[model samples]
Target: MSLNPIPNQIILLLLESYNLGANINLAILMSLIWNDLFLLFLSVRNIIVFFGPSPTLTKPLRL
Candidate 1:
């Protein structure tokens, strides 16, 4: 749940004039998304380019 607080602060400002709790929640969401998307994109890229698309990376296909 760690990101450059500047963007979060700016979004919070745009959303509600800046609130601490929402800021923290956004940070958590950003981290979670990064962790999930990182592996997902990596696996998909590998499968598409190198492995020619298989069922291995399709298990997490929630898109």
Candidate 2:
């Protein structure tokens, strides 16, 4: 098993949004954006988590 939680989070988010009465078009758009954002977030998080500290530190980051 992988350590990443992105896939599960995305699935839950999609399901929750659907349950909240999002239309097909809106759901599709939201899912696409959500998936992209989650992927970006996970990649950056993995880079920092696996690589440790670097010289690029300038300010605190938020997810």
Candidate 3:
């Protein structure tokens, strides 16, 4: 199994933020944070869409 691309991008962004260190500008950091949150929300939404809601007691069907 492989990690998703969007999560990978977020990790890179976070690493860049760490590299920015004390010299980091507030606006850029804020923007990056917002982008990360958006990506996370999107990933969760995608998972829900792909998996659908949890199963109930419905009988399993044979193909």
Each prediction's TM-score against the native?
0.45, 0.45, 0.46
Instruction: Write the residue-wise lDDT of candidate 1 on 1-63 in tens digits.
Output: 789999988887877844676889899999999999999999889877986656866678667
Candidates sorted by lDDT, best first: 2, 1, 3
* Cα error of candidate 2 at position 14, Å: 27
Model 1, residue 36: what's the lDDT? 99
- The segments of candidate 1 whose C-alpha lies over 4 angstroms from its true place after superposition are 1-18, 52-63
Per-residue lDDT tens digits of candidate 2, residues 32-56?
A: 9999999999999999989887855
**What are the clashing pairs of model 2?**
none
Between candidates 2 and 3, name the one with more favorable TM-score.
Answer: 3
Candidate 1 lands at a TM-score of 0.45
Instruction: Provide backbone clash counts, one per model.
Output: 0, 0, 0
What RMSD does each model have against the real structure? Answer: 15.4, 19.3, 17.5
